[model samples]
Target: MLVLPALFDEANKLRRLTVEVMQRLDAAGIDSALPDLPGCNESRQPLDAQSLDHWRACAMAAAAHFSATHVLTLRGGVLAAPPEMPGWNYAPVAGRQVLRSMLRARTIAAREAGREETIEALQQLGRREGVELAGWPLGAKLFAQLEDAAPQPDSAQVEIDQGTIGGGGLWLRAEPDEAPEQADTLAAAVAMGISTV
Candidate 1:
């Protein structure tokens, strides 16, 4: 299985949950790989130079490199999941929704600091040059791509509902957290899904 994590701050919040799910998958005798996106984690690539197309290419490369037969995309990660692969998208989200949340956060921060920032203005700036949201330096191309990016419709990909996990998503939390039961349930769900495939 190739696991693609949620983007931005949600990625930070879901790291532990992702790991927990991977660990459970390992215990279930399923192998998994979580490759770092080009501009994320330990990668030396500059975030400002990356676009959605680049990320999608990198994801396809990772899938091929890992010889993965299945993929699991979390939240905004769904936007980059390889369309040809059989997989599950856990609580899929559109790229614009992800960016809007970050943009709103930035606006709030600006207001708190006695500066005014509107979403429209920020989006205009983002579309022109780029904008740093929640510390991620997004390029104009990437920002523009995200503005209209949605998950590709693929019959091979199954959507995993949050309700199936029996709780609010980990991404909804303000900080990183662990939910052992959620991990257990999610892993079991994936295991079952793979078994039937």
Candidate 2:
């Protein structure tokens, strides 16, 4: 089976750790591939125009690259079982929690920047992401735990349970009001998860 990663957060800040994990997995002869989605790293596109359907198409293409079955850890609750594909399972990882956190960070950044337009845009983004970022501190806190969430499990090869294993600290594209460094760091972290270098 191919171990696909979560879209946005998969390669965010934890690039090194991600590569290390993949290397170990490959050495053990375990099959896996981190398909690049539209608007993500190395995929030529902007996040502003991406849609759920676009992501599904990218995933389908990735699945086609491999003859065996594919497993995806998708956020935004966007992944659905493909009728044409055999042996596919929908692992609904903690999408709601992640979305909530993303909204919080984005909305806060917009508010700080004094940009009403940006704030509205982020609110819309939050809605599409399927989780409200308004006043969900508890959920936000859980998501914040990703701040220190390790890219690799302590054992270096934790198995996916239920729907998640070591995926939590995702730094989504920040609002225009936010700092680019934060977003860059996040993107790097996610890349580490998919990297074999």
Candidate 3:
């Protein structure tokens, strides 16, 4: 198993969830790997130096390195799924949506700081030099690519939604915390999905 986590803030907030899922998979006797992308996790690579395609390639390489027969994507990770593998997606979201949300946050901050910034201006800046949003220095090339990215149609063999079992989105919380119920529900769903796959 190869588990792909959500990008940026979502990744930070959902770390526990990923661990829970991994534990469940291990208990079910399915070995799993959560490889860090080049510009992510504990990597030394600068985020501004990486493009979306680079991340995809990194994911493919990790999958190969781990001998992953199937993938497990969460949130924006759906965008990086290896084309040749079958997998499950847990609450997948589009890249563009994620970018737009980040942009909105930047816009608000810019206004508060008395620095005017429009979406077009930010896009232009991203095109020239990487833009920093919510402390993450995202590459201009990657930002541009995200503007038009949609989730891959065949990325996952199973799609699981746990919205109904939810509290608010953990990512949006000021202090990140765990949702055991949500994790439990998601783990059970993933286990079932893997069994069928």
Candidate 2 residue spans exceeding 4 A from truth: 72-94, 114-197
After aligning candidate 2 to the native by TM-score, how far in Å is the CA of 40 from where it should be?
0.7
The candidate scoring highest on lDDT is 1
- The alpha-carbon root-mean-square deviation between model 3 and the true structure, to one decimal in Å, is 1.7
lDDT, residue 121, model 2: 61
Mark the regions of model 1 whose C-alpha exceeds 4 Å error after superposition: none
lDDT of 1 by residue, 1-197 (tens): 99999998999999999999999999999999998888887789998999999999999999999999999999998888888899899999998999999999999999999999999999999999999998999999999999999987754789888998998899999878989999999999999999998
lDDT of 2 by residue, 112-131 (tens): 88965354465444444422
Return the candidate ranking by lDDT, descending: 1, 3, 2
Runs off by more than 4 Å, candidate 3: none
Candidate 1 clashes between residue pairs 3 or more apart in a chain or in different chains: none
Model 3 lowest lDDT segment of ten: 156-165
